[model samples]
Target: MRNSTALALAALLAGAGLTGGCGGASAPGHQGTPPKTGSSDINPQPRDSLRKGGTLRLSIQQWITQYNIGQVDGLQGDGASILTLTEPKLWFADDNGVPAANPEVLVSAEVGTSGGAQVVTYKLNPKATWSDATPITWQDFATQWKTRNGSDDRFQLSGTTGYDDIANVERGADERTVKVTFKQPYADWQTLFDPLLPGSAVDTPEKFNTGWIEKIPVWGGPWKIGSADKTSQTITMVPNESYWGTRPLLDSIVFRALDSTAITEAYLNNEIDQAPGRQPEAYRRLAGAANTVMRTGGRWDETQLTLGHAGPLADVRVRQAVTNAVDRAAIAAAQSAGLPFKVNTLGSHFFMPSQDGYRDNSGDEGRFDLERAKRLLDEAGWKASADGKTRTRDGAALKLVYVVNGNGSTDLPQLVQNMLGQAGITVELRKVPGNDYFTKYVNVGAFDLASFRQVDNVFPSLLYPVYRTGGDQNYGGVATPEIDKLIDQAGAETDRAKAAELLNRADALLWQAGHSVPLFQTPQISAVRPGLANFGAFGLRSERQYVDVGWTR
Candidate 1:
């Protein structure tokens, strides 16, 4: 099947990416070669009717270090652990990535702006219960907000720029109802309610602020944590029989940790049923087997080498020279294994392209040009120093330290380094564990370059923390009044095209300023075995949880 798809794609490439003679006499088009789009071959098993009883074994690259839903800092590739087994949100978005009007836990939720209250109200389903069997009520909702706000701790939802929009939340006259008020006209109200924690666990909002409360293990989601071993890298989750909605089809789910090579080997040997974030080559090998391969929309992280406007990098011409020097297309092509859609240093459309504000500025950023880069360096007062390998300005060599979360995608920094080397810049790569890397180092501005990933599913407002000035979470210290203004407008502009226009303007500015290097809009891909049911619910690349899955024996 892989061979056939490659052949078909090869046939299709003849007519595309070619505009006749301008690409030089020895152009790739003249070679009559077709481009690769990752692995073109995948034969997914036909959908099978739902059946139960088989244990679904999965070999994930990462382990579930913490079980707490709200406190777990990183998505950690263990999102299934958070969303499926341990906790439930007010509502889950549909396949289209839009918030659903009706959710399993809540009958309906509404935010009323008419009243001075500026409240977001939710009506809970009476049947819902914590894994411990306590009734989930509006009080729980109120407690969730208070605890998140008061905690001032790691997982404080209120402190997060996204959730800070809420003014306060209160219980309605009836215990089943909850009302929340926002301090400002901002989006992300959905995010506040979605990571709902149990209200019964605490007596006061202050007590809940401690991040450790998550270990107590109260849940309203479909499954409950039955057993887990942090050292052994295994976790077992059992269905919550008393769940308000449809019960999970599997009796239990076991997560086993394996490195990249080990995971692909295990899946090919049929030791595991599924795996996400495998290498592109691994997917290519698996495409021939009687299994299904799919892409998920999100990634673990990204790395950007930013110029400090207040420091030596204050010159706009220097920034442009840096931007023009590196070749994004070459980096993309190499990183993608010759796939046609390799993307390099993308602008501020940081969120996945599916979101309303995503604008593609690949052409505007300009492709790799060694000659142009040399010219820019000369113009910026950076002359080739005694060492041909390095560039110097004001007697200071352009030496940068690039850092990355030890557990993140390895392809990012490597590609950036290669591109920079071609443009005469020296970069030193540093790796740190995921925990200390983001909190102590990246957040506090310890590194010159880093790659991190942020998944914002609800709306465009997710950009506030990453893009705005003085944003607590802004790792690169990138602040642009133009970007902030456009993000603000894009968030409020309900009209699609207008919002895109505003977003594109912001994207161009980001590229022009050299704050971020636009990467590709990654596709959401997933690989599944035959007879796996309801697996597509895992959402693009299995980012979303699979509420329903069973086998067709």
Candidate 2:
């Protein structure tokens, strides 16, 4: 249930990130904790055993104005709940983080070599067709690779990770077959082509960047666009009648975008059948709701503080001081309060403690040491004021802006503010609308500090785009040479074990770099109707698809 690499790291980091923690309460006497090895809690129920039909209502923390997940502005909320229903993933992962090809889109996925270069061969499901009735083909695969390959700068992407490692993507024996040659033997090749885009959506830079803005121009999964009302900030997905796989039982699924507090209210008011129990209010309200069941699972996710590169944090020592000042234990305790689950503070950038490759690479940077924080500031030329309440250097107060999206726990930022204040640093809490959180804030380097969660994947390389310099998700603005080398070598890594070591070494540097500080594994807590099947806190199952999600009588 828990898992690494630049050779393998890219795959590991690739399928992850961007968010507010999803947390909640378990039933009385229920311990929502993961086994030491980690696990998922989706309340599995076979398709045939489920009820024939029912609408599933869900409250989502984020609504995508830019619907193309590969694009620069493409981050969705935790679990990407909307993407699961409306998009296509060629593969799916079980609780142990092992990948399996999705028969709905891929017949078989095999790894081998071509001219000594690692290659992956994919056979498309013959029955797989786009919403427009066009057959899903190798061209779609090729185009997706090309657009995200990082060759053209016009196409602002969230990641060039696995795509950039490819040597080429060509057709195989048939139009339905795809052959992708990698420049090196990257680990977890299955992480590629996730929510695979149609060529029409990615064939050109202009289309790839803006085509899906405020709209889903294409559909490739069990569902198609029913309506996306911007005014209401809700998306309605209906079953795709042309889908080749087993027909989805639900007539429609509606994802309503709401803040954490509103989501809790909606759940308690019975306006939404399923809601994220991340908000404390939700946990309290749903704790006694007869029809609601609390679901918690272990995940390859962590809530972190990303220090913006510009401003006072530009100095590495200042960043390190900030990291040293944070009491992750206290924050974790607060976030997990009133819940049976045990949420521990995270220590590595690449792996969760419950995962196999995990190591406490954080070292001294991860420790709470106010004295060391003061020393680091002093060494960085920041001096405490005569009053000793705040630091100042070069006519600038040692102040940092902490941006909050208003969708996550308010306690986190406040805690941060109070903790930093003790270290003679002034932290200003700036609240932003959830909609503009990333595009207008995190992505633009608009704040000195920010809080968010990353939902990780089996393929740790998915994190490449997150930690590298100018990485799409690198809001922290801290990328070290060693980290870069590991990222470069990740695609070249053939040995998973060695690759994991390489990732840990890089994470050590990540701690040393101090651009980002790991908080706790963002708790995945959900409140779902008892009848809901195959839907809940999906731990490390990043490769999951929504076809099997339905009601169990």
Candidate 3:
């Protein structure tokens, strides 16, 4: 669910996910360091070398209501950990985030120039079909483009990066082929039409919004939803009998929704096969556990505070003040403790430390200074309370609710609350159930400050949706005209280095405006059971043969 094509294709972060880091660790071993780049601790074995049947049990932070990742309500972080199993991943990416056609769904994708525009033609596998036997055709591609191209206000979307540049999607060489002509040059075009939604599911605004709620009605991947029970908070995935690729080696894959604490216990009790112990506290707890291998790698994610565009946060000075009030280095140190790598405070929104374009563009705005924080808040006209407590303006208290999905073992919510309080702002901590966190709150901008991880993609320009004005994914809704132009130029630039330069320039503006407070990049810390092939901390790589994941022979 993460990669790059024209722009970057990415996912949300859920659970107690260990995020962003530039360095890699040693090969996975008992109490050993996390694996480095070009190495994923998933003991991958060829299908012939794997066992016939087994269940890969894993835990997720929440149960998701929406099944479509393209929709606003559907873009849960844990939702990503499951959708690749049932949806079409037309392109598979390598460790470097370079994408290539997947033979199961695509035969070839050729790029060419058409009448001053860039056109990409996709050749679909004639054998590929949805779970209901609907062939994977040009219609599916056309529907996705229509729904996600930012031309329609009726369709609720997560983000329209590459899709926004599409001029049209037409059938080419019959129904199994699609030719997408871009309105402008989209440098990351290879990322479009991925996880292609069924045409019927998004043909209309009504169907697009509600068709996939609480149900996965159609699928075109290695596995199908066997059962999705909210009562049990578990999703059971079985092999898709109609899948036109290598048969899935495992009999089933089960995902159980458990809180952070429960997931830790489930792994230690041997009830689950994989556990994410990315934070220092949990990482130490699971380290050297009997019969477990701790796979560590570069996590291309940064935990941050997404400020709302509305309310008092709309003031740039207030946003910058709140950002400066928090101690990012302390949080990084807390999370990095006992880890084999040094976790640096994240300073860029678009690139992770592992990527080439990464730069500390934060400048002085990223530093922690209580005096500066108070000065900025005071300058913004939020006067300190008469009693020397919270700030007040026009007889109203300057208060904010910090919405969180899961209170990680790191106690990040508490730390942020205490620090913001010191700056004379009353921070209220509200814990939402994982299932409702995005749909009920964050997506709608229900909090002043929301805590989560922003998973960076290989292509920096793909972040346009997260930073551009009126972009749906820009939950904070903070953007200057200068930032927008830089992001636009970057997204259109075909040159990688030039595009990275433009992105960094735009990132500098975001820091000045306090779009988000980047805490630190996370690490891929997972305690995986022995012999679980092709499944572990995948690091910068996003593709895995879900069908090939099984117990090693």
Q: What's the CA RMSD for each of the models? A: 7.5, 6.2, 5.1
Q: Summarize candidate 3's per-residue lDDT along 1-553 as a digit string, tens digits.
A: 1211100000111122432222333223213333443345555677798889989887776776777778877766667557767878887777777777888888999989989999999999899988777788999999999898878989988888888888999999999989999989889887677778788777888888888887777888888889898898899989989888877888998888888778778888998998876766676677656767666566566677888867788888899998899899888877766665556578888887647778889887888988898999899899997665699888888898888775344288889989889999899888877557666787777888987766636556556777888877777788889999999898899988899899989889998998888887766667787677787767667645477788977
Tens digit per residue, CA lDDT, model 2, 79-166: 2446555667787777777777888888998899878989899998898887777888999989988888889888888778888889
Mark the regions of model 3 whose C-alpha exceeds 4 Å error after superposition. 1-39, 385-389, 406-410
Best by lDDT: 3
**Number of colliding residue pairs in each model:** 24, 22, 14
Query: What lDDT is reached at residue 347 by model 2?
Result: 88
lDDT scores in order: 0.55, 0.75, 0.76
TM-score to native of every candidate shown? 0.78, 0.92, 0.91
Global local distance difference test of model 1: 0.55
Total clashes in model 1, counting residue pairs 3 or more apart in sequence or in different chains: 24
Q: Sort the candidates on lDDT, descending order.
A: 3, 2, 1
